[model samples]
Target: MKLLVVLVSFLAACKAQNPEPCTSPALLSGQLTLATQNEQLWAFARYLYDALGQRIRLQEMGFYQNKSFTYDALLLYREGVMYEINNQESTCKKRALRADFHPMAVPRNASLMGQAVLGSSSGPGQGVLVNTWTGHLPDNARYLVTVTEFGCIPISTSYRTQPFGWMVTSFFNNVIGISDPNQLNPPGFCQDALHEEPIDFFSLFHMMK
Candidate 1:
């Protein structure tokens, strides 16, 4: 009986050490910064993401080629479309977006790297616990992503891909829910925006440069 009790306790401890996968909140808003070496672009954006509604909105400002630019993008995964609005020129363009909504979660195939506390772990409420995972992507790209262990809030993501070098995006200042649902709507100017052939969303930044 004594040996059985000890074995049960050991199994419980092992289970506690390896957590199950977690998904982020369905609705969230946050600030994100992105950098890409090959593109030589640095961008900051305020984003409203609605995973349940399958849409997202981004108000982005970036510098490339020593020039500053700003734009707003509304991505509708369900509609398979994206609206890119140039706030400065009051011009908008609509294009196909052949991507599905990707929730901020650790992929099932991801290999766990490790876990650590971001600050003092000696005391409760003194630090955040996080987990890191790495996986390969299509096109020979690889990714390493970190997220808060509790809510699965994304902390950072790094992608190594051919032709693009490395691109890193860090997320911060996240709030659990969308404050304004109307923010998901496209701007009025986009109503009659000219339809263009589908293009990769990231390439839009380079075109502006």
Candidate 2:
């Protein structure tokens, strides 16, 4: 009976030390997949990624208060790619591009920000939030955003040709609505990355609302 009790205790201890996979911000950055049934979510995610990739330079400009870093006011749902590829004819303050609406297969080491939010489809494209601080923005500035109830899991079986690991998902909202940096009181785990500068902006991306 004593041997049995020790064995059970050992198993319990191992399980406790190994904890379950992360389910919140950990799921925010990295490859993501959604069912075809979840088309709205998929569309939102693609547009967010495209916007991040396209406007990354502009985001960096904001760090130094360089509005010139602000690209033309071209909306991103339509003509963003053209403007990004060839910056000659862009006139607006923002750019828009079509969301990549196909089955996406992103690789490892890729992740999106928590504060990135999707605007209401019914309303004018108004408050899409993007956290520039993840890699490009800054530390002293309170630019960190929050994502709730995020989760991730690796598929045990798949026939895809490329290698894949985990499918991380998060319930994130727009960063535009958050309180100013001075208001957040204490910093968070996500905010820890902020102070570490000379960041690589390429690794950063936006998340769909």
Candidate 3:
């Protein structure tokens, strides 16, 4: 009985030490990093309306000069890949979420090398996303994408389950490492992902329109 207790305690301790093996997905690779690294966040934002067609249409946008935001990239650690984007426009426009927020761009096939830039000096931000397929990538062109990072401020799932909004929020909270402090309650129809608190989704949409 004593041995059994010791074994259980040991297992519990091990579990506590390693909460979860966190692995970031590779967003690009090689020379692509050069094109993307050290670039402004909003420079490459675009929106992809129809992804099913042969040639995907891309609508790009820039950031509001007044507001400063974190730049992001798509990284696949397991595959050793990364993409760099550096461009900015001056405009504040609204389009269909399908056409404005989510744009589809093509992925590069070539590879290049670079001295790994330290975290602070340059390179990807904390907006890292993991374990999620970036839907379908284009074959001929490099698709402009916006990787938005979101945090669950305080909301419970039980109370809130908006259509596509909550589904996204939940993905950020449960799978992407973003944690929520409050239970999502007052369950009702919600249209925004951030129905309750500030949940940033700028990290996921690489292509912002």
Candidate 4:
């Protein structure tokens, strides 16, 4: 029918009007933003890496009590350097990379806040991770730490995924507005709780080809 032919032509015209760009570049450098109006959780992650992904470094702000953390590391063959500065007082140290656990999983009894314990999540991205256990906080600490944001970009031209790299999870945070940190108990995965309060977020660094 004439109407069907017109619809096809219109669709083809729209496709020709705007096409996707070359997202798969030899190297990529971009910013990651994770924020909310209440300021309960906010962070900026900037990263730079090449096609092979042999070397990479990322700078971040607002992971803990408005603290900043940095990673001057590498990512290749499931291995690389791991350098992190928790706060101004904590000096930077080079250590072997440990991809065994999710990067967002914080150490127990972390001095920052909350003498409390943390649970693990198989979520995407290194955005914000906050799965806190409320009852037993070691000493004197502020937040129970059931909320966090992190990112892991696997950049390589040969990388099977796309855009020569991937941001598995970027600036992902799942924080619920509650009177107490313990009151915030999210689902198993951040994406599972997307419809809830204090919505969780994940950002796309570059468009995929």
Highest lDDT scorer: 1
Measured on C-alpha atoms, candidate 1 has an lDDT of 0.85
How well does each candidate superpose onto the true structure, as a TM-score?
Answer: 0.90, 0.23, 0.20, 0.30
lDDT of 4 at 97: 48
What residue runs in model 2 are displaced by over 4 Å at the alpha carbon? Answer: 26-58, 62-94, 100-177, 180-209
Q: Candidate 1: list runs displaced more than 4 Å.
A: 87-90
lDDT, candidate 3, 122-157, per-residue tens? 456623421111222232322222222222111111
Q: Ranking under lDDT, best-scoring first?
A: 1, 4, 2, 3
Instruction: Tell me how candidate 4 scores on lDDT.
Output: 0.34
Off by over 4 Å in 3: 1-110, 119-139, 143-176, 181-209
Model 2 lDDT per residue over 1-209, tens place? 99999999999998775322232211112222322222222211211222222221111112111112222111222222312221353222212344432111222222334334445535666644332112211222212222222222222111211112222233233232223322212112222222222211111222111
TM-score of model number 3: 0.20
| Each prediction's whole-model lDDT (CA) | 0.85, 0.26, 0.25, 0.34
Among the numbered candidates, top TM-score falls to 1
Q: What's model 3's overall lDDT?
A: 0.25
Encode model 4's per-residue lDDT on 1-209: one tens digit a residue: 99999999999999774322112233446655544433334456665544443344455554433444443322332343343332344344434443331232333543333222234335554333322222222332222223222222221110012222222224323221212322112112322212212111121111000
